[model samples]
Target: MSHYAARNAQGHHRVHKNDPEAIAHLKREHHKFRKLVDRINAAKTPGAKRDIAVELHKLLASHIALEEELFYPAVKSRGLADEVKEGLVEHDIQRFLSAQIEAMDIADPLYGTRLGVLGEMLVHHIDEEDDEMFQEAKKLKLDLDAMNERLETREHQLKAQYARTGRIRTPALDREVRARNAV
Candidate 1:
């Protein structure tokens, strides 16, 4: 039996270890992101590349919001503060790069270069979260099934909101915009 199987056999596996819905959802998102990255890299025409980039941006923005709003808080509450903090910083970096890519003309040579760099950064971030952070989270006694339900609901709401507004409403960004409008 595997280590996880053995742990479960011993009745020591956490709720997340047994039923990892939130983690599963995050992994599915990562897989989709990876496929989109590959498509972006293989795009032949500038228009195709631009279209894929927009799709990627929307997908990643929603994914980041899901993590920041739900997954990160759950993990952080379980004593994974460092990983959550690093993940937030990485998200900021990705947002900056994504905005830069969006501003550049698709025909520009640097556009592809920036897209490639963003793909690499995304891959690295995904690997770290999947390999290290998720493992750590599984060890904790978190109610992952509840977290999963919350994430799923929020993800659906965000997608619908995006469909209407064409942008992800991140909490931080919403707060910032609200504060600015109040001035």
Candidate 2:
């Protein structure tokens, strides 16, 4: 039996698909993005509005990239194929919206419409991950403590990469981390 299954006395093996630390980080990013969105909507100066919107776009895009690269793959590999697949589709949808948001003119009257659309998509995407994916991941019998440790390490690496290079070094580091931690 796997170490994970061995640790859990239950007959069935447990899997912790989503690490709490990573989920917490994602939630924080969501909150930050929402705040930026609100700030974008409330700003009076076009320059300030545009600047906030641009930064908000970059933040959302990077957060999504990090999640896709680090988080989703780990959860998907934990036997939740359907959930991960759905999440990928949602990620694509969000990416499309992100592109739209990125391209929009913040000074245009239609900007509000695009921002509204982006907000709706973001809210829905976050809700799905938090409610469905997270709950299911929490039930998995995997070593969440170890997973969180790996996530912390990877998040640090990703942060450094983004800081120095301004790009997410992707595909995913999760697979390698998971394999190394595999029972």
Candidate 3:
């Protein structure tokens, strides 16, 4: 039997699939993300598109922080770091594109096209997680309630900071920290 599975009372090998409550929350967030992207695509007014994109960006940042800070570490502890490597890169790519989108004027010709590309990449990334990373997580011995609480706590922290400062962390702050640490 694989390390993640054990013998049942009937002497049959049983595979473990610890479906954390956080997984459900992540799925719901994924659904919301898809809806927001669809709203952006279908919006008739530039103002509406810009508003929805801003909301989407805030939520996306929180979601990414939760995954990076908590969810990915938990999975990586189970010897699945390689499985999540692509996801981390994907997050960085999305963040770069998002920054460009935020700098863009809605009237710019590439604005719609950039949003379209981001939406396409997001859908592809989510599907990849659902198919591969999620399946891998199912085998790990993650605590359902504890994992959920951890995710919620991280999300709450990110959301509150975003509400107060309009961003989780400013690039200037990051650079300052790196400079201070280098001394």
lDDT of each structure?
A: 0.78, 0.62, 0.72
Could you tell me how far off, in angstroms, the CA of residue 91 lies in candidate 1 after the best superposition? 0.6
Candidate 3 residue-wise lDDT, 1-183, digit = tens: 121111121111111244457776676677667778887878877777888999878887778777777788789888888877788778877877888998899999888888878977986787667667877787778774578898887788778888888887645434533454464
Q: Runs in model 1 with CA error above 4 Å?
A: 1-19, 173-183
Candidate 3 lDDT trough over 10 residues, lowest sum: 3-12
> Candidate 1 lDDT, tens digit per residue, 30-93?
7667777777777887778789889889988889888877889888988999998898778877
Q: Find the candidate with the highest lDDT and give its number.
A: 1
- As for candidate 2, its clashing pairs are 14-140, 14-141, 14-142, 15-140, 15-141, 15-142, 16-140, 16-142
- Return the lDDT, model 1, position 11: 21
Per-residue CA lDDT of model 2 for 1-183, tens digit only, reads 122112222211122344465566665666566566667666776667777866666666567666666667777888888987777667666666766766766677776676667766776666667667777777776555556566667667767877898655455443543454467
Off by over 4 Å in 2: 1-19, 157-183
- Best-fitting candidate, scored by TM-score: 1
Error of 2 at 131 (Å): 1.3
RMSD of each: 7.3, 11.5, 9.5
Ranking by TM-score: 1, 3, 2
Q: Give the lDDT of residue 72 in candidate 3.
A: 85
Count the clashes in each prediction: 0, 8, 0
